[model samples]
Target chain A: MPQIAQIAETYASQIFWLLVTFGFVFFVIGLDMVPKIEATVGARDDKIAGDLATAKAAFARADEIEADYRKRDADARSSAQHLIAESKAKAAKETEAKIKATDAVVATKIAAAEAEIKAASTSAMAEIEAVAADAAREMVAKISGASVTPEAAQQAVKAALVHG
Target chain B: MHQFAIEPLFGTDHLAIGGYNIAFTNSALWMVATVVVLWIFMLGGMKRELVPGRWQAAVETMTGFISNLLTANVGPEGKRYVPYVFSLFMFILLANLLGLLPLGLVGLHPFTFTSHFTATGVLAIMSFAIVLIVGFYKHKLHFFSLFVPHGTPVPMIPFIFLIELVSFMVRPFSLGLRLFVAMTAGHVLLKVLAGFVINSTNAGAGFGLTVGLSSFALMIGISALEMLVAVIQAYVFALLTSLYINDAVNLH
Candidate 1:
C-alpha cells in the first residue's frame, strides 16, 4: 500500500499540471483573446499596406516618365508640322510675287509697242495725202491742155471740181 | 524504482469530515501543483511583447488557438469568452495528457500495485458543473424553458417536452463524460500496455530488450494519440458550452 501510495503521488503531479492547463485556457477565454488576435492581424495588414503604397508610388513614377516622353514627342512632331506648313506658305507667296512682277514687265512692253504703231500710222496717212494732191493737180493740167493764171486756175479748179 | 499501487478511498478506518469520508488524495495535491505550474507559465508569458521567447510563443499559440476557435464556432458573441474557453481547453488538454506520465498507486507487494488516483474526479466534474451553472447564469431567466421549442401541436407538446428535456439533461453528461472517458481510457490503455511490457521484461534475457523497445514504441504512439485527443476533448467541451449558451440566447 505504501508503494502504491507513492506511485499515485507520481501521477498526482501530472494531474495537477492538467488542471492548471485547463484553468489557463479558460482564463484566456475570459480575458478576451479575440481583440488581441485582431490587433495582431491589423498590425500585419498595416505593414502589407505600407509596402503596397511604396510599390504603387514607384509604379506611378515610372508611368509618369513614360507619359512625359510621349507628350514631348507629340509636341515636337506637331511643331515640326507647323514649321513645314509655314515654309510652304512663304514659298507660295514669293512665287506669286515673282510671277506678278514678270506679268507687269510684259504689260509695259506691250503698251510701248502700241504707242509706236500709232505714231507710224499717223505719218503714213500724211504721206498718202501729199502724193494724192500732186497726182490730181498734174492730171487736171493735162486734161485742160493750157497753163492758166492764178485767177484762171481758180476758175479752172472750180470748173474741174464742178465737172468731177 | 518505486512501484505504484491504488489506495482505496477509506482504509479499514473511515476518515470523517462533516459525516462524509474524506481522503487527502493525490487529486488535491495534483490540482494544487497544476495551479502553481500554470501560474508560472502564465507569468512567464504575460510580459507580452512583439518578440516573444519560446515559452511565450507557445502560450500565445494556445491563446490564439482558442481565440480562433471561438471566432469560428461560437461567433463573435463568444469573443468575450476567450479566456474561459482557453482555460477550459488547456485544463482538459493537460488533464487528458497527464495520464501519460508515471503517476500510479504505490504498494509493498508487486502483485498489489495498481493504477489509481486520477485527476478526472471531483476537479473535472466540478469544473464542468461550474461551466454549466455559469453559462445558465449568464442567460438568466432566458435559460429556463430552453427545452420548449417555440411552436408545436398541443397534443404532441408533451412528447417533445420529454425528448427535449432528456436531451437537455444529457448535455452536461455528454460534455463531462467525453473528457472523463477519453482521459481515463487513454491512461488505462497506457497502463495496461506498461503492465504487459513489465511482465515480458521479467520473462527472459533477450526478450526484455524487445519488450522494452515495443513498450517505448507503444508509449510514443499513445502519447501522440493522446495529444490529439486532449485538444479534441477540450474543443468538444468548449463547443458544447457555447452551443448551450447559444440555445439559451436564441430559445425559439
Candidate 2:
C-alpha cells in the first residue's frame, strides 16, 4: 500500500525521465543502431553469395577449359595418326615403284644378254660352215681324184645354213 | 525498504515545468543507466567483421533474435516495429539486470526502474497504443470486430463481446502489473531473507551461525532464481507486446 501511495508522488518524475530515456533509446537503437546492424548482416550475406557465385563461375570455367583441352588433345592425336598413316602409305608406294624399276632393269639386262648370245652363235655357225665347206671339197677331191669349185661350195654352205 | 524510496536528488521538492514535475529521481537515474549501458552494448558490439568478434556477435545475435520474434508474431509488417521492440526488450532486460549490480557505492542509491509501476505501465500503454494505432489504421472499424468470435451464436454475442472488451482493456494493466509485481516481490523477498540472516546471526552465536548459513544459502539460491526470473520477465513483456500487436494487425 505504501509502494502504491509512493507511485503517485514518484510517477511524474519517473515518466518524465522514462520518456526522455526511451526516446533517446528508440532513436539511438531503432533508427541508428538497428539499421547499421541489419546492413552489416545484409552485406555479409551478399559477400557470401558473391563468393559462392565466383567459385561457381570458376568451376564452370575450369570445366570448359578441360573440355577444350581434351578436344585439342584428341585432334592432335588424330592428326598424328593421319600423318603416320600417310607416311606409311607413301613408303609403301615408293617401295612398289622401286621394285618395278628393279624389275625393268633386270628385264633390259636379260634382253641384252640374249642379243649378245645370238650374235656369238651366228658368227660361230658361219665359221663352222666355211670350215665344213673346205673339208667337204677336200674329201670330194680326194675321193674322185678332182678339184672342187669354190663358188658351188659357198652356195651349198649358204643353203645348208638356211635349212638348219 | 529505503532502496525503493524516491527522494528528490536535486531540490527539496521535485522541479516543476509547465505544471508537470520533471525532477530527477532514483528511478530516473537507473533508467538513464539502462539506456547508457544499452547504447554501449549495442554500439560497442558492432564491428561488422566478416567473422564477428564476441561483442559484434552479441549485437548481431540480439538483432537477429528480435527480427525472428517480430516475424513470428507480427509477420513481415512487424519489421517496422523492430527498433521499438528491440528497445523495449533491452530496456526491461538491462533494467532488471542492472538492479542486481551493487551500484550503491559511497552515497549513490541504485534503484530498479522496471520494478516501478510508472515505468512498466508507460511501456504497457505504449505497446497497446501501437496495437490500437496499427489495428485501426489497417482494419478501420473492423478492428472493433476483434471481439467477435468466428462461430459465436447470435444470442451469446453480447456476453462474449463484453468479456472480450474487458480483456482487451486490461492488457496494458496486466502487462504493467505483472512485471511490477514480480520485480517488487522478488526484491522484497530477498530483502526479508537478508533480514532473517542478519537477525539470526545477531542471536546467540552457535544457533545463529547455523541458521545464518542455511538462510544465506537459501537466499543465494533464490537470488539465482530471481536472475532467471529477471530475464524471463523481460522476455515475457516483449513477447506479450508482440502478441498484442499481432492480435491487432491480424485481428486473430
Candidate 3:
C-alpha cells in the first residue's frame, strides 16, 4: 500500500502540519471559545435563578398585602357594627324616658279637667233645684190662697230632690 | 492505492528539512483544511448568544459532548485536558468524514490522513504520552502499581503484572492501527465495488443491469455505513483516550 510505502517520505510533513493546525485549533477553539460559551451559559442560569427569586418575593409580598387588607376590612366592619349597636341602645333609652315623662304630664292634666267638671256640675244642680222649688210654692199658694216662706220653700225643694 | 498515495502539492516534492523529505503532501493539505473547517465551525460559538442559534448550538453540542466524556471517564481532573482531547477528536473526526466526501464526482480525490498509520500513530503517541506524564507526575513510582490489581494472588502477581504491562504498552500501537485499518479498509471496499460496477458495465448490458446495478446499490449502502464508521471511530478514539487518562489519574 502507498500508505506504507510513502510513510518514510510523508511522515515529516504530515506531523509538522498536523502540529501547526491542531495547535491552532487547540488554542483558538478549546482555550478561547469554549470558556466564553460556558460563561454565557452560566450567566443565563444565574439570570434565570435571580428572576425566579424576584418573582417569588413579589408573590409573597402580594400575599401579605392581601392578608393585611382582609384583616383591616374585618376590623372596620366589626367597629361599625359596634357603633350601630351603641347608638341603638342610647336612642332606645332616651325614647323610654321621654315617653315616661309625657305620660306623667298627661295624667296630671286629665285629673285637673275632671275636678273642674265636678265643680261646674254641682253649681248647675243647685240652680236647677231652686227653680223647681219656686214653681212648687207658687202652685200651692194659688190653690189654697196661703203665702209660702223662701226658706221653707228651699227646705221643701231640698227634701223633694233628696227623695227623688 | 492511488487515493492513499502522498503526492506533493505546489511542486514541493523537492523540499527537504535536515535529511528528511518534508514535502507538503495531500495529507498535509487535508490537515490544514480540517483546521480551517474547524475554525469556521468554532466561529459560530464565538457569537456567545445566551439563546444560541443553530450554528452555535452545533458548535456547543460537540464541545459539550467531549467535555462530558472527559468528565465521566477521567473525573474532574479531566477538565484540564479538554483542549487537547477536543482538538484530537475534531481533527480526526473531520479528517475521517472529509475523506468520505462524495467529491469524486467533481474529479477531486479527498485524502483521509487518518488512513495513514504515521498520522494516527502520532496522535496515539500524544495521548499515551499525556497518560505517562500525568501518571508519573502525580503518583511518582506508585504509577507502576497500575499494572497490578488489588486482589491479585502473590504467586500470580508477576505473571499478571507482565500481562498488564504488555497490554499497557500495546495501547498506542493498537489505538493508531485501529483507526488506520478501519479507514483504509472502508475506502478500499468502496473502491473495489466501484471497480465491479465499472467493469461489469463495460462487459455487456446483461451483466451491467445485474452485477453493476447490484454493486452500485451495495456501494450506496456501504457509503452510508462508512459515514457511521467515521463518526464511531472518532468517538471511540476520544472515549478510549479519556479512559486511559482515567487509569492514570485514578491509578486503577
Candidate 4:
C-alpha cells in the first residue's frame, strides 16, 4: 500500500492551486459583476442623453426649416398673384424648391437612423459569435479532447445556425 | 510488462523536491485533462439555440444550475456573474471525477493517479481566493471595512482582523479538502473492496466463488455510492464558494 503521509506531502501543492482557482472564479463573480452592471447603466444613461440632445437639435433644425418654408411659401403666394396677372411658371418653381428641401432633410435623418441600427446589430451579433465560439472551444476540449481551430469553431457555429 | 498496480504510490523517502519528500506523481497530468474537459463541458452546446440539441441541453442544464445559484445567492444584480460561478463548479466537479474514469481521456497510468500534491490543484483554490481578494479590492475601502463587524467595541479591532484573516486563509483549505477527501476516500474504498474480492477469491474454499460474487456485487453498489458522493462534493464546493462571495460582497 502507498503511504498516506507521503501522498499528503506530495499533494499539498496540488491542493493549493485548486483552492486558488476556486477563489479566483468566485472572486470574479462577486467583484467584477457589480461594475459590469454599472457600466451597462452608464451606457444606457449616455444613450438617453444623446437621444435627447439629438432630438433638441432636430427640433431646432426643423424650426428653421419651417420658418424658411413659410417665408418662401408666402413669397410663392405673392408670386402666384403676379402669375395670375403675368406668368404662373415662377410661382410653381418656388413651391417645388421648398418641398424638395424639406424632403431631403427628412430622408437624411431616416438614413442615419438606419445606419446606426445596422451598426449596433452587427456589433452585437459579432460579440455573440465570439462568446459562443469560445464556449465551444472549451466544450469540445472537455468532451472530445480535441483542439479545435477558430475556423472550425466558425464552421460549427454556421452549422448550428443552419439547424437553429 | 508486469500487471499494473491499482494502488497509487503516495510518498517516497528517497526522492526529494525542495527538501520535501517526493514520489512519482501523476495528479498534474490529470488536472490538465480536467481543464481540457472542463473547457469542453462549458463550451459545448453553447450555440444558444432556442431548442437545444442533446449536447447543448446538457450543457444548458449545468449553465442553468450555476446561473440559478448566482441568482439565488447574489440577487438579480449578480445574475450576470453566472459565467464565473458555473465555470467554477464545472472545474471543481470535473477535476474531482477525472480519477474515477477507468480510462478517462487519458488512462490513469502509473504516471498519473500516483500521489503527489500538485500546484494545479492549489492553483484552483488560490485562483478562487485571489478572485475574491481582487473583488474586495475592486469594491475598495468599503470591502476592506467589511472585516470589522458593526457595533463592535473599538477594543475588538485587531482581534476581529486576526479572526477574519485566519478565516479567509482557511477558505481554500476547506474548499479543496472537501473535494479531495471525498474523491480520495471514494477511490480508496473502491480499491480496498477490489482487494477484498481478489483475496477472497484466492482463499480457496468451496465457497470462494460465492464470496467473490458477493464482493463484486458490493463493488457495483459502491460505484453507485461514489457517483452520488462525486455530485454531492461538487455541490458542497460550489455552495461554500457562493456563501463566501456573499459575505465578501454584501459583507453581512
Candidate 5:
C-alpha cells in the first residue's frame, strides 16, 4: 500500500528526471551518433562501389588494348606475306629476261660459223679443179703422141665437173 | 521490503517547492547513472572503423537490432523514427539490466527504473502519444477507422469496433504493466528465493547446508532467466511501439 501511495508522491520527480535523461539520450544518440554511424556505413558502401567501377573500367581498357594489339599483329603479318609474294614475282620476271637475251646471242654465233664453213669448202673445190686439168693435159701429150691445147683440156674438165 | 522506498539524497529539510518533492533520490541517481552509461557507450563506440572493434561492434549490433525491429514492424517508412525507438529500447534495456547488477548506494536497494510503473508508464504513454499524434496528423478523421474491421457485416461492425477501441485504450496501461510486473515479479522472486537460502542456512547444520546449496543453485538459474527476461521485455516494448505506430499509420 505504501509503495502504491508513494508512486503518486514521487511521480513528478520521477517524470522530471526521466524527461531530462531521456531527452539527453535522445538528442545525443539521434542527432549525433546515429547520423555518424549512417554516414560511415554510406561512405564504406560508396568506396566499395567506386573501387568496383574502377576495376571494371580497367578491365575494359585492357581488353581494348589487347584487341588493338592483335589487329596490328595481323596487319604486320599480312604485309610481310605480301612483300614476299611481290619479291618472288619480280625475281621470276628478271630470270626470264636473262634467259631470252642469252638465247639470242647463241643463235647469232651459230649463223656466223655456218657461213665461214661454206666459204672454206668453196675454195678447196676450186684448187682441186685446177690440179685435175693440169694432170689430164700432160697424160694426153705423153700417151697419144698428138699435141692437144691446155685451154681445150681445161674447158673439158669444166664441162665434166659441171655435169657431175 | 524497503527496497522500493524513496528518500532525499541532498538538500536538507526535505527539499519541497510548491508541494512538489524535488529531492534527488536514489531513483534519480540510478537514472542519471543509466544515462551516463549510455552516453559513454555511445561516445566510446563513435569510432567508425571499417572493421569494427568490440565496442564499435556492440554499438552497431545494438543499432542494427533496433533498426531491424523498426523495419520489420514499421516497414521502410519507419526510418525517421529510429532515434526515438532506439532511445526507448536502450533506456528500458539498460534500466532492467542495471537494476539486476547488485550495485546499490549505501542504505539503498538495488532497483531498475523499468520496474517502476511511473517510468514505464511515461514511456508507454509517449509511444502511444506518437501513434495518436502521427496518425491524426497523417490520416485525420480516418484514423478512427482503425477500430473498424475491413469487410465486416453491419451487425458485427459495432462489436468489432468496440473491441478494437477497448484494446486500443488499454495499450498504454498494458505496456506499462507488462514491464513493471515482469521486473518487479522477477526481482521479488529472486529476493524470496535468496531469503529461503539464508533462512535455511540458519536453521541447522547439515540439513541447512544442503537446502541452502540447492536453493542457491536454483537462484542462479532464476537469475539467468531474469537476464533473458530483461532482453525480451526490452524487445517486446520496442516491437509493440513499432506495431502500434504501424497500425496508426496504415489503419484498418
Candidate 6:
C-alpha cells in the first residue's frame, strides 16, 4: 500500500497544503461569506414581518372607518326622520288653527242673515194689516150707503178678526 | 497502489524547510483543488439577494446544515466552532468526492488525500487538540474527571477510569483511521474489480461474458455506493468532531 509506505515522503507536503488551503477556506468562505448570506435571509424575514404588521393595521383602520360611516349614516337617517315628524306636526297644528278661525266667521255671518229675515217679516205684517183696513172701509160704504170713518172701519175689522 | 503513490510535483528536493522534504505533490494539488471548488461553491451564495437563486440556496443549505449540526451536538457554545467545522467538513467532503470524479475516463487520475492517514491524522489531531485546549482552559484539572463516570462506586472508579481514559485517548487515532481505511478500501475494491474485468476479457469471450460483465456491473454499483460513502464519511468526521467537542465543553 503506497499510502502507508510513502507516508514519510508525503506527509509534509500534504500537511503544508492542507493548512494553506483550509486556512483560506476558513477565513474567506466561513468567516466572510456565511454571515452575508445569513444577513440577507434575516433581512427578508424582517421585511415580511413588517409588511404583515402594516397590512394588519390598515385592515383595522378600514374596519373602524366602516363602523364610523355606519354610525353617521344611522344618525343622519334619524335626524331626517325627526325633521319630517316635526314639520308634519307643525303643519297639522297650523291647519287646525285656521279651521277654527274660519268656523267662527261663518257662524257670525249665518246669525246676521237670520236677524235680517226676522225684521223683514215684521214689516210685511204691518203693511198687510193697513191694506186690509182700507179695503173694509170701502166695502161697508157700498153695501149700506153709510159713510164710516177710517178708524171705525179699522176697529170693526179688528173686532170681526178677533171674533173669527 | 499506483493511484495512492505520492510523487513530488517538482523534483523531490525542490522545496524543503528545516530538513523536512515538503515537496508539492499530487495530494497537495487536490487539496488546493478542493479549496478552489469550495470557494466557487461559496461564491454562488455571495449574491446576497433577498430571494436566493438555486446556487445561493444550495450554499445556504450547506452552511445551515453544519450550523444545525453544531447546535445539536455541541449546544450553544458550539457556535464558536462553526468556521473550523465548516471548513473541515467541506474540505474533506470535496476531497473525497473529487477523488471519485470519474476522471479516469479521460485518463486523468484524481488523488484522494483523505485516504492517506497522514492527512486524516492531521485533521483528527486538530480536533483532538481543540478538545484538550478547551477542556483544560475551562475546567483546569477538573478536565481529568472526564474519565470517571458521574456516580461511580469508589471501588469501581479506578477500573472504570482506566477504560474511559484509554477510550478517550483512542479518539484521535480512531477518528483518523476510520476515514482513511474507508476511503482506501473502497478505492482498492474498485481498482481490483477493474483489474478483474480487464483480465477476464483478455482471457476469453466466455470468461469475459461471465466475469468481466459481472465485475463491470458490480463496479458501477460500488461507484454509486462510493459516492454515498464519500458524503457519509465527511458527515461522520464532522459529527464525531462535534461530539468530542461536546465532551470538552459539557464535561460529560
Better of 1 and 3 by lDDT: 3
Model 5, which residues run further than 4 Å from truth? A1-5, A70-164, B11-18, B48-52, B104-108
CA-only RMSD, every prediction: 10.0, 6.2, 5.9, 44.4, 6.7, 6.8
How well is each residue in B51-127 modelled by candidate 3, as lDDT tens digits? 88999889888888888999998899898888878888998999999999988899998999999988899899989
The worst-scoring run of ten residues by lDDT in candidate 1 chain A lies at: A1-10
lDDT of 1 by residue, B52-75 (tens): 678767767766776677677667
DockQ for every model comes to: 0.15, 0.42, 0.49, 0.08, 0.37, 0.51
User: What clash count does candidate 6 reach?
Assistant: 0
- Clashing residue pairs, candidate 5? none
Chain B TM-score, structure 5: 0.94
Ranking by DockQ: 6, 3, 2, 5, 1, 4
Q: Candidate 1 lDDT, tens digit per residue, A1-164?
A: 33334543334443444345445444553354434644554565677899899999999999999999999999999999999999999999999999999989988988898888888887775565444445555666789866544455455555665577
Taking all chains together, the TM-score of candidate 5 against the true structure is 0.76
A1-164, model 3: which lDDT tens digit per residue? 99878777678888877777777877887788777776776687798999999999999999999999999999999999999999999999999999999999998898898888888888888887788778878987888767788778888999888999
Interface RMSD of each: 6.7, 1.5, 1.4, 7.7, 1.7, 1.2
Chain A of candidate 4 gets a TM-score of 0.38
Ranked by lDDT, the better of candidates 3 and 4 is 3
Q: Which residue pairs in candidate 3 have backbone atoms (N, alpha carbon, C) closer than 3 angstroms, thus clashing?
A: none
What TM-score would you give candidate 2 relative to the actual structure? 0.78
* Tens-digit lDDT string for candidate 4 (A27-77): 543244323433444455687899999999999999999999999999999
TM-score of each: 0.59, 0.78, 0.79, 0.51, 0.76, 0.77
